[model samples]
Every structure is written in C-alpha cells, then in structure tokens.
Target: MAGMMRRSLDAFCITFWITVFLAAISSATPIEPRSNAIQELWSSVRTLVFPPTNRCKVYPGDPEWPSDDVWMKLNKATDNRLLVKPQPQASVCYSGPFYNAEKCAEITPVWGSSYTHIHDPIEMMSPVAQGMTCLPPNVFDSHNCSRGGFPMYVINATEPKHVQLGVDFARKTGVRLVVKNTGHDFLGKSGGKDSLSIWTHHFKQIDYIEKFEDKKLGYSGPAFKAGVGVQAFEIYKAAHEKGRTVVGGEGETVGIFGGYIQGGGHSPLTSLYGTGADQVLSFDVVTADGKFVTANSTSHPDLFWAMRGGGGSTFGVATSVTVKAHPEMTTTASRFSFTSKDIGNETFWAGVRTYVDYFIPNADAGTYAYFLLLPNVATGIFTFSMSPFFAPNKTLEQTQTLLQPWFTRLNDLGITFDPNITQFDSYYEAWRSSFPLEVVEKINATTGSRMFPRANFETEAKREELYQNLRKSSENNRVQVHFNIKAVDPANADNAVNPAWRPNILFAQQAVRWPVNATAAQILKIRQDFQTGDMQRWRDISPGAGSYLAEADRLEPNFGQAFWGTKYARLLRLKTKWDPQDVFFATTSVGSERWKVESVDGLPNENGKLCRVR
Candidate 1:
C-alpha cells in the first residue's frame, strides 16, 4: 500500500508538470510576440509589453483536474470568475487587480495576454487591468499617491502548479516579474515600468486544520496550514466559527500572507499570542524552477529560518502558510476620543504625552493602543484619535483602569469621552469587526497578505519631540503627516511560511498624503508644511526610523533604510542567491539594478548559475 501510494503521488506530480508546460505555451498564443525583426528585443520586454491578444490557444487534460485542456479550462473558469461591476474608465486601466481577463490583458500586455489563458497560471487569476498609465498628468496617480506605475496583470494563483508555471517561465525568459499577494504594497512593488506582474490574490485554499488537542507541531503549537490568500481576518473568522482562535491583525481587509506577514503581522491579540509570523508552523512554496517544496524546522531549516522575518526577496513564490493556533479566550475592546479645545492647549498635549508614555508600556503586554493623530487646520484645533483593542477577556473597569491615566489627562484639557465596550461571542467575531476579513475580497476582486516589521516601534521621548516639532510647524500649515505605532506579539517559532520574515515582532506605519500629483507649488507646500510641523515633529528619531510599505510616499530616499530597517542586509543576501540574474525585479524591490549584485556570503558569482540551498 505504501509503495502504491508513493507511485500514485509521483505519477500525479509528473502529470501536473507536463500539463503546466503545455498550458504555459498555449496561453502565449493570444499575446505572442509578432513575427517582427524585433522579436529578440521584444522578448526582453516580454513581461512589459502586451503580446497582441490575437491567436489560437491550447491545453491538455489531467486526471486530477479531470479536464486537462488549458485554454478550454481557463475559458470556463473566466465565466465562473467573479467580475465586479460599477468600474470607472480611469480606475479600470490604472488601479489594482482588475476583476476581469480582457481588460487585464490590454493594460498588462506581457503578464496579462501572455500569461493569461494559461491553465495553471490563470486558474486562480485575479486580473486588475484598469488603472493609471505612464502617459502624463494625473495618469500616474493611484488612490492616495501619484504613481502605481505601469500596471502588471497579477496572475492571481492558488495551486502549487499555478505558481510553478508562472515562476518557471520567469526563470526561462529573463522577464522582469513583479509578484503581488494583494496589491497592497505601499512601495508600489507589485507593478513597475515594463514589468510582468504575477498576482497571488486567487491563491485562496485552506487544506488542513488542527484542533488544539492534537498539537501537530509536537507541543510547539495548536497548528494548521492554509493557502497564501488566506487572510489574517479570514483565519480568525474561520477559527472562531470552529470555536477556536488565533492572534493576527485588527484590520478587516488585510491579507495574512501579503505585506503584513512578510513584515510581521500585529494586532491587539499579539500581546497575548504574538505576531502572526511567530505563530507559523511551516510553509510550502513553489520555487522559481517550478518545484513544489516545503520549509520547516526539519526540512529546509535555513530557508525556513529566513522566511519568518527576512522579507520577501530571498525566496520564490510561496503558496500556503501553516500557522499555530491558540486556545480561544474572552477579550475587551474600547474607544476614547478628545475635542479641539483640549488639543489646542500645549499643556494638555504635554499631559497627554506624559500619560501615554507611562501607560503604553505599563499596560499589560496583552493590552495595546495607538493614538490616531488628526489636525483640523481650519480651527487650529488638534484632537486625540485613539483606537485600542485587547483579548484574553477583560472587564470594562479592568480595561479602563489600564487607560485611566491618559483618560484623566484628556479631561484636564477639556476632553471627555464615553467608553464603548462589548463582549464578543468569540475571538473571530471580534476579529471580523476589527480586521474586516471580507474587505480584501471587497477592495480587490482577489486578495493576499504581506508584513513589514520595524526594530523600533517608537519611544515616548520620540513622541515628545514629534509633538514639539508639530507645534512649531502648526504656524506653517504642514501637519498632515501620519505617525503611529501599535504593539504586536511574536510569530510562533514553528511556522512554515517563507523564510524571510522569521525575526520580526512589531509593525509600524507612517504616511504623508499631500497630493497625488502635487504640482511644483503643491509639492513645495507639502514640503514646507512638513519642514515646519510634520518633518520637525519626528526628525530626532528620523535617522533609524522606518516607514510602512503600504503607506508609501515618494519623497523617501534609500527605501531599504526607511522601510526594511534592520534586516535589510539579510534580504539582500537572499535576493542575491535566488535572483542571481535579477530575473524577478521591480523599481521598489530590495535588490534593485543599482544594488552591488554580489554573490551570497562573498562567494564568486557563478555567472548566472546558482546552487539550491533548500
């Protein structure tokens, strides 16, 4: 029986390989390079230019899928694939994962037309064909910024074969491939000039679950595995529905494996369980060569270690993540606010700062809060925007006592607030409202997650300097800079996801929304505003501080220092090895064309050749 089982598995893998190869070629039909003399040059820009979407396509049948025809299967899938309506002309060609196929191709000639219709690649397709262009005017602006660059058809993938096919082609073709989980990267990594984008949004599959009683990780966790598209909020909700719970982000739309986990996911529950990465049990990924592989403590240990917090550049396409689960417990969430009168008073701001410094670290490791700072320039009124959440179940009084110091200080400033607290039926219920799981599904036709961990969340001394600077800048009108820090727990030591993000423990976000395409005057106004109020506020801590990838602003230079922070070097080394040829790249990637491009550990470059460590 064992021999037979092995044979069966081997046969399925072989068949899967053959099918993907055929599908990859067939899908190129609609967008094959013209029989022009520029075929060679065009190939270099293959992923960048859309292959004319006019040609015959084909595919073969496989037993597992039952209908091994590539072109045919994809045609069938498109009909079933959900296409969101009410799309605007500007938005369809200039934004995120387009919900349809044809439009996706028109915008991303290389990835869309060439890679689309390929059975395995587009099976989980999440095409975002509509968005801004490289042309001019407001053409480059996206929702909050002025550039998402040229759109890349994110070939949303799910099954290992799907990822395997896309990556294999990238390695063979030398086409610049931009990989995206949820198109949520603030750095605009998932798309770039003449880039072929592969989307992992459609990679939503939950294969296994472990009850806390079983402890599949051997005392390390109440662990289970899921696809890359399984979001933090979705995981929380799923666990809650099953009467279980896990710690993760507090947002509704954040993807679990996209940027948040890649950086280090955090939430109110982190105080108790730790960051989402800390809880991973193992990870299964499809490498650049089309191999379906696993990374865990016992297998591919070094790669496993690196994936947790090293960042995404070192590894290939990761499809699913296995995470640790904890016992579900009760919890409390509370909200408090302050008015303009209290905010305008410097003494009040100082008192609030003093209390926050004292209370933040003193709050039980399980308790967490982030003050949302907003300034109403029209009134010269500043108000305290605070959002707090915690779990392991606490009463209103208990939660209030932890927050009382700051609460009282606000009253001293003429700020008073009513506390809102409710007992959640389960952690998932709380998770749903807090994180909004379905938001990912709503925002884009597809979904995925990412992580961005920073060594320094922030210090109270830093906060004081920030407010002081802002006070002076207030006279100049530049206080729109967003600064924030939220507490996070460590990831489970045994998680089996990508190896790049294993060491992160906290998450931070900072944003400056001036103008999408601020004119020279507008740009100057924003800069002047920050120079006085925003920039000076946090300038003291600026040297070592990092910014969030998703809340990207173009002004920052050497993004590696400002975003990846401490672990930048490790990511570089891994990137050097995996992408020795720099095949998978974009303007915002860790190892950009400008990087030294050295061999790993100072080894001599193998001249485009690399050895597999895992």
Candidate 2:
C-alpha cells in the first residue's frame, strides 16, 4: 500500500510539473522560454517537497541547489570551460590535498602584491574582503584554510557567449553570481560565497579604431575598444605606441574597461581630458536576462548613461568598451618628501596648509598631485611624501613656475626639501617613472574617503578649517590625498558619477590598520574607530560632498547617497529595470539595501549566504 501511494504521488508531481512547464513556455519570452520553463519546473518540484522559509537564494547544501548533472550541462554549454571546485590560491600554504612546500615558498614572498592576485581566476587583491580565511600561514595563528568568500566555481569566459551562459545558469539555478576581471575589487564585489563566477581575465583583445565616428553623440576621433581583461598599463602602452594616450587609473593592474570606467575613473589625466567615463564611446554588456547588447549614446542611451559611472556588478557584465584616445603629450613629474622631525610640528602643518591652499590653483593649471600624509603617534612625527606630482602638457620649467610660490613659502617657513622634478616627452613615460607599484593585501586595514569640493579651498578660514580637520584626522590614521579634479565636458555631464566630483578639487582617504591576528573584538573596534572617529571628521566638514564609489568604506552608512548622491534614485530605477530579479549583488551597490549577507560572529563579512530582506 505504501509503494502504491508513493507511485501515485510521483505521478501527480510529474503531471503538475509538466503542466506548469508548458504554461511557462507559452508565456515566456522568445529568448528564454524553453530553459526557463525547465528550471522553473525543477524549482517548483523542489519547493513542494522541501519549502524554504526565507525565500533565500539556494545554497550548496539546499535541496533546491543545482544538481551535479545540471552543472555538467552548464559546463557542456560553455564548451567545457567551467572550472569546478577550484581551491584558493593560498591553499598551498596549508596542509591540503594541493599542498606544495616549494610552490608555497615561492608564492608567499609575492603574496602581498596586487600582481600576484590580478592573474588568478578567483583570488582577490583585498584579502580582508575575502574574510582573510585563507592566507599564507603565519606564526600567530593555526587556522585551517578554506574557500572563505571565494566563489565555489568559475567560468573561464573567453567570449561573451560564455558570460551569457554563466549568467543564465546562475539566474536559473537561484545561485549567487559574481563577475571578476582582475580581482582588483576592494569592497569584495568581485568575490562571493557559494557563487558561480564569470572569470573575464582572459578577454585580452585590443583594437584601435582610427576615425571612429558616432553621429548621434557627434564624436569623431581615435578610439580604442579594449576587452574586459585589459589593464591600465596595457592600454596606456597600446595608446602610446599609436602616438596617443588614454585616461586611466594610477594602478598598473587596474582593469580599465570594467570597474575603473564604470566607477568614473579618476586619473592623472583627469584635469586635462575629463574622466575615464567621459571618454567612453560605447560598452558591450550582458544584461540580467542573459542578452548581450551594446550600450552607447545612440543605442540604449539610458544604459549608456548609467553604465558610464553606475558602479560595476550592478546593472550588467561589461565585455568590452570603446573609449576616446587623445594625442600623446609631454608631462612634468615631481617627487619630494619632508618629515615633521626636520621641521617642528607647527612648521610641518603650516607647510601642509600652504599645500592645501594651492589645490584650487593646481586644478586650474590641470595638475594632478598624489601624496601621502602619515603621522605616527608613538614617534610623534609626521611624514609627507609626494611620490610624484604629475603635470601634463607642461615643461619642467613651466611646472616649476607653477610650484614656485609653494616652494617660496616652504623656504620662508624654514622647511628644507629637494624638489626632484623631471620632464618626460610622453605621458606614458612620465606615468611609468612617476607612479610606483601599489601594494595590496592589507587584510587588517579599513578605509574611508571623501571628495572635497572647490569651495573647501576658497577662503583662508575654510582652508584653515580643512587643514585642521586633516591634521586631526591624520593623528591616528594615514591620509592619502589625490588632487585630481575633473574637467567636465558639458556633453558628457549626464553620467551617474557622484555629483560632488564635478566641482571637487581633491580626494582624501583615511585608513586604519590593526596588527595581524588581532581578535575579532579588537578588529571590530579598530574598524569602528576608523569609521566613526577618523572618517567622521571629513564627513562633518563636507556636508554635501560624496565619495568615490570604487574606493570607499565597505560598511558605509547610507551608501546610496554617499556614492551616487542625487543620482542614486535614477541609478536605482535603472537597476530595477535592467535587473528586476536582483540577479547581481555587490556590496554597497545600487539596490543592494534590499539584500543582506548573513555574516558570522557579529563581524562584517561577505563569506556567508546572501538573502533578500524584502
């Protein structure tokens, strides 16, 4: 009798699923009907037997999780490019099945560098975002290495179709999805737990288009269509070879066509040629419905506007982008440093005040200054290091002339420092010589940033206030300042970048780092102090100003307004329209407030199951 009942139930289930599947196919769109119907039927059947209480995304152990057969089918669909059950890059450091002492020793030395992580399929440059679960084994701890927040599987996507296949599979299977280009994401957006990742690091195609014309936008110039995997140095070199230059980030390994431009990339060339987003001609992206489309001023204008600075992994996956290229020009580079020990604290801060006062004039002169202000509490010393201040289209004498007033002021203040200024014939040469390789893998540090507008430097009182706040903020933290002001073009002002950036004169970041192997409570305290204490000082001064979304505090409050400002509403609307199902989830991105990552032990972490809150 039991067998008879079981047979009857099975028959009923099959009949119900077939009816639902057929109905779905009839109502579904032409592009996704058959596959959608099958996936819906499978999910419906699983829900009937084992219902989920939270309506959360399917986890690996859940009954609704895609079967091995389903993953196999996806692999076959992608032409067998799927990488299943991949281990973390640091897995070799631990006693694991893939352990190797020689390989571990070799990797351990360069493990902290961004170069080591950029080429990896799933490794992230920011280890803290990955929960620091698997790192080179240190003497302080004996924790076992795990995947942590890294994706469980990856699609080594060499083409757009592979990306489409990966997106469709994740959407259909109710699994988390993430897109990784160079793993250079600082906010953990490129990695997620129990996710199926689309690895776009192999999209290394670069084509230069001469006399590219866009009638709708009235753009006719030299442009380069770079693949998703193209890095800053690669594009810079390519453009230099063609006797042209492109606006890009300072970091050599930063992906240009992906997150950099999408987040309104600020560059040493920004003051001269506008932002990286402003230079964009078009983007080839795979939207939420797994449809590949090109977004430009003429076609899909809204998507184009949003894609320019809407932040990455929110609207869609970008496959390639065509960006404007400018004629190669000369650049003047300067490097100098002085410590408070040389001059008293009063004189050092006075020098800083003079430097702050020159921000507006520097912006007017189209100069980009990148420097660091580090104050050590224990040693009672303040160190100011200007690795290289970049001035484009200016000769060495012209650059020095611009800085003569500041130099005179320093001399009067009894501050002795050498201005190691030099000139390069090309922007690429100056960039190569000026900017040092950025160090990554700061697992214990938390950062917050602010964009200071031109008004902050207008009056002596305002300048004094800015200097005081900066000094107070740097008392217990490190401050990295970039005097990169955007030269906004009226034609491209409709992008979704933080509006505060338009009139901004400088961007300042405050960072706090704790010792390695700090306790969870200690780490929490450090992060809290950095946010509420150090960053709050900047926030109090810049009331209406916003921060650069790409390099901001991960747990920032009111992130929408902080990142997008007045544009947040429109960006959210576009996000809903393009990705209604919320298939994409990046930390602090548009429409992300509706979802939450269930962190472990009351600490902020992405290494947990993501679920909808509403």
Candidate 3:
C-alpha cells in the first residue's frame, strides 16, 4: 500500500499535498502511508492551498445524490490525477516587520496560497473581523501573504474522508479550524491570527429541500448543508417563485447557512417566524477529532447544546444547516422618519423608554423591528429609521396599532408622520428591496464585534447620551460613527443550542467608520477614538457590560465576562475536552488563557501565539 501510494503520488503531482502534509509540520520524520481515504483527503487540500484555474467546481449529480453515495469515487480519481510534490526548502512566511517590500513582492499571484479573492486582508475578514490598519493602512495587504490574520483556510473538501483529513491536519498543526461561508461575520471570531480557518465558502452544494409534509405546520424549507453560499434572498426568492418562503437574512447577499444563522440571525420575516437561527432543523458539523456528525437534540447532544449559542468558533466547523423557509405572502413595508430637531433628546429618550417598556411585553415575538434615533443636523431634523414589517396573519393597521405610540407621541410633538410605505407579495422582496445588501455585505464582512443575545432592553440614558455625543466626537475628528440595534425575542426555553439563547430578548449595537485613514497617524486617532468611545459607552452603561466575542477588540482583556459572561468557565472545559492540545487557536482566542503560561516543553515559538497542537 505504501509503495503504491508513493508511486501513484509521484506519478501524479510529485508529492504536492504530501508536501503540504509534510511541510505543515516543522519536523522531517519519515512518512507513512495508510488508508485510501487519506489519499483522497490530501487531493482536496492541494487545490485549496494552491488552487489552479477553476477553484470551486460542482460534482455531477451532486455530491450526495442519494445521501449515501457522494463524490467519494470522483474525489479519489481526482486525487490520483493531481500528484503530490515535495515541500519548498524554506517555510512560507507572511509579509512581516510592518512593510517588507520584498516580502510583499512574494504576495504576487495574490491568491496563490489563498482560496478566495483577497487582494487584501480586509476583503478576507469582511466586516466581522477587519484587519488592524493602524500602521501600513491596508488591513488586507500582505507581503508574501499566507495569513489573513483571521485564520481562514479554505478546505476543498470532497468527501467526509477529506473533512476528517483536514481536521487531522489542523489538529497536528495546532491551527484552529473555524468554518466559514461567504465570510459574512458580524463579529470577527471566524478568522484570526495564529488560526487556521477551514473555509466552507468553496463548498456550495445543496442536497435537497424536503418540503414540509405536515399541512398544519404550513412550513416548507430545505434541509441544506452549511456550504450553500446563495443568500436568504436567493433561496427565498426561489422559494417565492415556488410559493414558499424561509425565515432568512434581510439582505439578498448574506450567506444563508454560514455563521449567520448559527450566530442568531434576523431578517424581514423575523417578526412573522422568528430569527433564522430559530428555524434551524439540524446542523451538519465536523467535530474536533475530524468525525462528521449531526447536531440537534439527540446526536452528540452536548455539541447540539453548545452550537446553538455557545458562541465559540472552536466549537466545530459546520458544513450544512437545515433551516426553516416560509412562503411568500403579502407584506407592508413602511419607513417612519421623525423630522424635528425640536424633538428634544429628553422626549426621544422618554419615547424610547416608553416604547421598550410597552413593546418588550407585548410586541409579538416573531415581529421583525428596530428604531434608529438620529438627529439630521442638515435639516434641523432629528430622524429615526423605524420600520416595522408586518408579520403574516397580521395587518398594517394592527402593526400600526401595536406600535402606534412610537409615532403618536412624535405626532403630538408637532412632527408629521408622513412616512413611505410599500406592499409586496413575498416577505423577502420587500426586505431585500429596502436593505442595502451590497452595502451591508460590504460592511457585514468587516463587522468584527459580536453582541451576545440580550434578553432585555435596559441601558442607562447615559448610553444614549454617549451616542448623541458621537457627533461631538466626530466634530473635531475625521471619522464618523453610527450605531444600530437588532431586537430579538428569546428562543424557546427548550432550545438546546446555548444557554445564552435563553436571553429571549437580544440586541446588537455598533459604531464604525472612523473619521480618518490613509495615514498611520490618522488611523491611530480613528482607532483610539473608537476604542475610547466604546470603553466610555461600556463604562457609562455597565462597566461590566459584555458584548459578542466575534467582533471584540484584539487587546480588550477581561472578556470572560464581556464575551462569555457567566458561561466563561464552562466553555473552558469544552475547549479542553475538544482541543486538549490547543491546536485550534487565535491570537487572543477565548480559551487560550490557560496556555498563556509557558509550556514545560519550550518557550513560545516565533508566532508568539501558542500552538498546543505543535
């Protein structure tokens, strides 16, 4: 078997992936051949690290045509086609020392080692985990680039065997293998420095949509693998064409099954059905040991329990997610803007408090909602971007009545409620029409901070005031700031996803787009300003306030409370259980504190970041 494997590999690509499998290690131990599955696995990894022309190709008749026989045989044949090669004498290095022009030259054929179209790291991080542009400025720019600093490694996985091989490789290399689809991270946890990300972005296969048979449920959706990249709008649009709708992302561009749903996603139909995450039927995941598994209520129950809301990138890499899709029905879309600077801050605050107090108890849990408190200085008008998409089985008047107070008070305050309203057939068309999916995608890719699901809406007036102070902060600086709120109802108590999911009421707040850039000095001010404002807001609101770990800052300490809060300790055990070697890691990833102390074996490697798997 060994001789055959060697001869076959040499005939193919001269040890291509075998070199990666070998080069991945720092040692020169003799190689050994094993199962044919191992052979196919290496076949997939090569094209990924050093892809040729057509990167993401779909297998004929689909990979899982009958759910039993996938692309296993084809993958094996392809593996035989691409011969493995020897590793380069020296290890590949990312452009370092903050401006190595020669190293940057090494970055040519940019995607030479990349799996996606990344001219820079920012494109790679997306909005969730933007690269720190304090110095050289191009957050994504890398000389001789191999690292996205986000640890995103696209795996060209063909079969379950390939997935296991990738997992084994990551385990051996001490690289955290978080999964990704379309790189739509609201918080930057998916990719990080000192991490090896297994990007599912290339895995675009959708097996089947076993339509709901229960007539009473009136629900029909797809049982999809997480690799599907077409957005909620794409699938919903297709479903709409077929008289079906799935609860999914508002923007047509957001990846449907990627981290969004798993991380608690919301969309236009949210008001009607609930969050995209709530509609999940099951998750197809690859565990820490490289075994393929399904997570729900019964299988690997603890994992099922964690993936729901444990909020850890290290939990597992999910390939497919079966989600609930809904039918396209009539929907009303309206934009309510408040055109009055005379709308005193006090009045606005009181109105917000009243609205929260009133709606938190009665606003239908499934109703999608939000209210933006903005003072448009140009028009001497204080405006709010408040739009409530009417849920199915509900009327515009009924939604108006439920949320009437929010507008009536302002009307009484002498502001006209002349808002723009539109009605559409499919729930998605309306939401997709209004949301800047392109802009959102542009921004969503860069959103790095994650906000844990908030069960309640209660923050001091000071927080609002601080936001109001944002205009002041921007008054002298070059960067501008904005904030948004995502109000979500609590998941069913029986939900086994994450205990934090129990915080039925949740909201995400963000302030981004600093005043300056193009210069290190300008970038520093922008970063400092963002940090200062963020810290002040937290300190003023709740000095111990916690946010999502995905988009948290690289240097913010004491995140045990802020990111994980009460569940910090338990996540540790889970981390230990799955990643005992600390193979899966990020520079400041959640569970790495345990390994911060020097290892009895040696000093930290050049990476400075720990590599337990090493």
lDDT of 3 at 196: 36
Ranking by lDDT: 2, 1, 3
* Superposed Cα deviation of residue 355, candidate 2 (Å): 0.6
Error of 3 at 555 (Å): 4.8
lDDT digits (tens) for residues 1-614 of candidate 1: 99999999979876665565445444432222233322332233232211212120110121221121322332233332312121222344444553344554454443323132222221212122212322111334334322223322334454555555456445444334556665444434454322345567666666446543324345444555667766655677677665667655665544677556655555566556555666666778665545667876677665665566544533666777777767676666665666557445565456545553543343343665545445566777766555644444666566667667656765675656775765665666554554322211111111111222232225655556544544544344433322122333343354322222322222323333344444435544554454344443443444454544444333345657654666667677776765554555533346653532122223111111122222
Mind giving the per-residue lDDT tens digits that candidate 2 earns over 128-216? Answer: 88777888785223367888788988999998878877776666557889999887767878988888999998888999999899887
Q: Measure candidate 1: CA RMSD.
A: 13.4
| Winning candidate number (TM-score) | 2
Say what the RMSD of model 2 is.
4.2
Shift in Å, residue 579, candidate 3: 2.6
Q: Per-residue lDDT tens digits of candidate 3, residues 325-393?
A: 555676655666553356665565444444454434333434555444444444544445564433443
Clashing pairs in 2: none
RMSD of each: 13.4, 4.2, 11.8
Q: Scored by CA lDDT, what does every candidate get?
A: 0.46, 0.82, 0.46
2 or 3, greater by TM-score: 2
Candidate ranking (TM-score, best to worst): 2, 1, 3
